[model samples]
Target chain A: MLQPLRDRVLVRPSEEEKQTSGGIVLPDTARKRPQEGEVLAVGAGRVLDTGLRVPPAVKVGDTVVYSKYAAMQVSSEGEDLLLLEEDAILAVRD
Target chain B: MLQPLRDRVLVRPSEEEKQTSGGIVLPDTARKRPQEGEVLAVGAGRVLDTGLRVPPAVKVGDTVVYSKYAAMQVSSEGEDLLLLEEDAILAVRD
Candidate 1:
């Protein structure tokens, strides 16, 4: 299991997408990646200047939607994972 | 000008992309969006539990590469913008 440190989160992106409302098959060469993923790990949250820990909101195994371009790419065990802060996570999918 | 509050950032995604290292021109519907963007706005750093502000690292107008899926979508002045946290930003392009 991977554990992110200091407000970082690990996510596995979903390899699926839907067409734009324009009905145009936007090529990958023209747009950014989608923002759908499954949570893999979460850090202990950022430490405040006062030395307090801010726990993250989402937990491991949660599905979430984030900004299309809002996390760092990391490779683990030959798999592509994302490390992001809790604030980077926009919403958790139910 | 838009001001993000509390660890949020605004980004304008770059509209260009290159072929993957595999040379496969993956269609947008098959893959996620790219992670290239220009910073448009940023929020103040998160407030610590001890009444201190963390102050974000990146600033407005900085070019950054972020996770494909790590921010929220917000609209301003008829433009699509992304609101993300500082930690979501992977790297600043020098």
Candidate 2:
């Protein structure tokens, strides 16, 4: 099991690519990197000045879409891993 | 100036794609989204239990590389924008 530190989060990218509403296959050259993924692990919430832990809104297994250029990539166990902070995440995909 | 909230960071992506060491043009389909960007703004640091504000390491104009699938995108002023937390950032490029 992977555990993030501080407000960091670990995410696994979805293997599929996003298609435009028109069904045009946005080539990898045209489409930005896939910015959607599944949450694998999350860090403990950050402690506020008031000594309260503000839990993150995201959890493991949650599907999310983030900025293509907003996370750090790490190689673990021969797999690509992403580490992000909670605020780096935008919204959860339903 | 844009200001992120609660460890959030604002980044402007570099419009260039990453080429493999062999110079293979990883098509948009073959390559991931360009996860490299320049830091535009950062949020105030999270308050630690020790009552210290741990400032973020990223600052405006600093070039960075992040995870493509780890940030949220927002449309601001007709430009595509990305919002991410500091932890989502990987390494700063010189």
lDDT of each: 0.67, 0.66
Backbone collision count in every prediction? Answer: 14, 13
* Poorest lDDT segment (10 consecutive residues) of candidate 2 chain A: A17-26
Question: In candidate 2, how many Å is residue A74 off?
Answer: 40
lDDT of 2 at B17: 31
DockQ of each: 0.10, 0.06
Write the residue-wise lDDT of candidate 2 on B24-69 in tens digits.
Answer: 4334532364478888777776656765668998888999987655
Write the residue-wise lDDT of candidate 2 on A1-94 in tens digits. Answer: 5679878889876675223313443444222433667898899977777787867767899887554445677767776777887766655655
lDDT of 1 by residue, B1-94 (tens): 4556567777886765222323443445223544778998776677767856798888878999876453555555686666666777878999
What is the DockQ score, from 0 to 1, of model 1? 0.10
Candidate 2 stretches with Cα past 4 Å from truth are A1-94, B17-34
Ten-residue region with minimum lDDT total, candidate 2 chain B: B17-26
Q: Chain B TM-score per candidate, please.
A: 0.74, 0.73
